[model samples]
Target: MDSEKELSGKTVLLMAIATGIIVANLNYIQPIEGLIADSFQVSKAAVGVVAMLTQLGYAFGLLFIVPLGDIFNRYHLIQIMLSLSILSLLLAFWAPSLIIFGVASLLVGITSVAPQIIIPYAAYLAPSLHRGKVLGNVLSGLLTGILLSRSVSGLLGSVLSWQYVYLIAAIACTILLGVLHLYLPRDPRQKQHMQYGKVMASLPKLLAKEKHLQGSAINGFCLFGVSNVLWSTLAFYLAHQYHFGSGVAGLLGLLGITGVLFASIIGQMVDKYSPRMTVGLGILFSTLSFVIFTSLGHLFIGLIVGIVLLDLGTQFGQVSNQAIVQSLSLQASSRNNSIFMFSYFLGGSLGTFFGTLAWSNFGWSGVCLVGTIFLVLALLGHLFLKEPEKLQKVS
Candidate 1:
């Protein structure tokens, strides 16, 4: 049966729930940084190690793990990962120090492969005409879960303590594992995939051949670099400079979420019009939004307004960029997403790192400067020529 035909009562709920739970795992560390540090009797920098460990785990997982979807029984793989992720969460919850907690965070990060699975599943299930919009819908859920994780983590830490935050996430992980074991469909494609070695060796060859793919990857890279800076460091500015707390900073995430909704709408428009327009407009807002944030630093209402614009800019560009990449590859659909999203996450990781660096050096002003420069580069990356044509970046 077509997978669409299988989106029946239990299956739909199971998939949605599984997707949300797994995706939410990515952000569970943010809200409880202070508490986690106190537990270990370490400085805040020690907990920062957990964030890097998890991000590195995710980067390595995408390098090896997400690609496995093309060549394995994703159902079984997801189940195994979710089980291990639950164990990891429990480890994080009960850890005595930051070192042990960092190890647990690494395990949890590597195993939380839900969004990678969901994106490809959407690719497999949806037809071309509706793919962009459907992918946007799925991404909207993913982004919302990401934003809300901080808030939920805050509340969980507030009422019950931070350790309980991970425990609750463990419970969530267990529930998702059960649902996937019972309901997610197994793919026949697993048996048909090539040797894993060939798949692993092919990234260079793939990049060597596809100019459009490279452009798409670069687009994702530059665009997400800007977003990574804003979201990662804004909380520091709000907390230290403005004297805001976790509650208020978490609320500020809604600005990005609102931008995501607007971007989702723009993604649908990509299907109806020129993809170049989508890229152009998205870049425009990204640059402008950050400028406003920088220029109006002390004005609370202006910061809110700028963030809303900033997020809309980012979501629109990202969704459209994915659509562009996916449309270029017929046989390499999963591989296409692997490259595109790898660049997206890779860019985010680097962006966050650099944003932190800038925050350390130039303070909030420097952070916004880095963000604006990336946005301008993204915009200029589009300026030279074809959206429909490939970029000159690759040889």
Candidate 2:
């Protein structure tokens, strides 16, 4: 055993590793959609099957894996999941067909428990006064992971085979896993309330009982819908419209990462002022991004500006959403986060599915429409959201 004494400095490093693990899995998959479709000799629509499966896998992980935090020793659970994540990524890399690729992606998604583990870990580490800040910083890494994964993958896809990308991630995960085992703080809690059937049964009642959590989750869903539309299809649109190669298209992801780089600022603001204010401002930025994109008329600068607004707005809303969801269910933070994140990814899957089709049909104009609608709906959800009793007490 390490020590009953705190791991101190290692917690942040552990959080970073956890964030990186999922980023390596999820974002890397975005730019390669077209490539994978071609590899499978399937229509673009079928690529959605892959996206859906990956998200479904994530939802499964959220439901089945995250709850263990409230029940088991998180230390052991994280190690097992991290190891499985490594094996899953390897299987994904060496898979024979797109069919196998999809399956591996699903498993990798399932085992990518990095975020679930780390968020709670952050909660466990910080004092209440600094809890939101710690979470924000850690989550910023997760968001960055989500952004850079696409950006880096797009930048690298043409130069190297996609399998090598997963291979690189596998190596990274292995190093991080070892580091975590060596240094991560031990869990303070034990497994107790893990009746899987009971947890599943309570979801509906939980949703009904916790309207605030539901609303926050809905808002997150819409926010992710906006982001996923762009990420899932932007490479195709940029390539098809302006005849730019993967490199420039990938650079757009960096432009959007501007938002992620600023998420901690939003977190700070959430601590200082109201989460609603940050969310409202984010909605405005998101709307501006969509409008600029539609009017860009294939000018490169227009694309750059669009990326900035979209990413910033998306992440701002996300940071606030995380704050709100975490506040709403102190007893069931993991479960609440799971539901909230699952909705967000579900919306992403829908955005990726329909957004890709819309792109093929109406081009950038179509994507702008999808993003605009989702952002608007998200804004509405945020506006209508009420803080639960526990959140108010925390505030």
Candidate 3:
């Protein structure tokens, strides 16, 4: 480990920007799903499969590819992944059939694991005392990319065609790939020469032995599921309820910046206080957001407030939970992060799937119910699960 080398602010910003740009590939199709449905002459519910498959592919990458970070040169691995990501984006841009597009989406998700790699690398480079704050700043960039991706895609899909969004994304990735090559430092840590099989096998053992990992993973699963439930069905709801288009749905994503603003602040709180406290606050804000959604979602202002709270709550829970998981072991940091992120994105996949199902069958009411159920499960895990003694004293 490069424990002695201090992480510079400029490098941290670079990593954050790299993560934001790379991760944006997985989200560009979300706001534009409705447009995609129209282009392919498919039902709104059927088009949702694209979103589900993308997240599932992300989960698959987290489990299989991210662990390689511990074994290989992460800088090389990231460059290779970003290179693959550009190919996938171009494939999506040129896809003629829905099936081909779905396949390209899956590939895009699989190759977009660079952000996960960068995150663990950042954690390793940062000082333990300020790790949470550093993570928060990086996460802010990531969250910003996620929010803006929807808006940009929505606007582009509104003006141009939906496929152009993917083309533009490909060009963006190509540019970022060059910038990272020029400025990003190579991994300074010595490589672990463990066989890939052994690295994969160790994941299950880590989950079984680490109570804190188990708790944090479950919290991540449910909390992220809650966030996806709302986001996955949001465009459909707007179209049905208010006669809105993909453009309006995309605009709503801008509201989530309100939550992104709090990411670093929440990270600082995790550093000074406890991950548990921030997690509880996250759950509280998420639960309240759902309450607003269920009761007052008919109003434009109500939806806006709910969106802000949902993002805020999700930011709090995600950053704090990650800090806890990353703190468990620096040597195993990549593997640890893979486990947490796998569960997290798995929840996202299922959430997108079920939220679409709920919207199809029971409308917005059903979507709210599904989100509530996820929150209830998250609360149970947060209140009942125990943290490690060392984690309780992060300061």
> Could you say which candidate leads in lDDT?
3
Supply candidate 3's per-residue lDDT for 343: 96
lDDT of each: 0.69, 0.74, 0.89
Task: For residues 276-344, write the lDDT of model 1, one tens digit per residue.
Answer: 788777788877888887888668987888877777777777677767766765356566677777776
Candidate 2: clashing pairs of residues:
71-191
Model 3, residue 185: displacement in angstroms?
Answer: 1.6
Off by over 4 Å in 3: 1-6, 388-395
Provide the lDDT at 226 for model 2.
83
Candidate 2 Cα misplacement greater than 4 A, ranges:
1-10, 387-395
TM-score quality measure for candidate 3? 0.97
TM-score of 2: 0.92
lDDT of 3 by residue, 193-265 (tens): 8999999999999999888899889888988898888888888888888988889988998998977888889
Which residues of candidate 1, in runs, are more than 4 Å off?
1-17, 34-46, 188-190, 384-386, 389-395
Pairs that collide, model 3: none
Tell me each candidate's TM-score: 0.88, 0.92, 0.97
**Number of the candidate with higher TM-score, 1 or 2:** 2
The model with the greater lDDT, 1 or 2, is 2
Candidate that beats the other on lDDT, 2 or 3, i.e. the better one: 3
C-alpha RMSD of candidate 1: 3.8
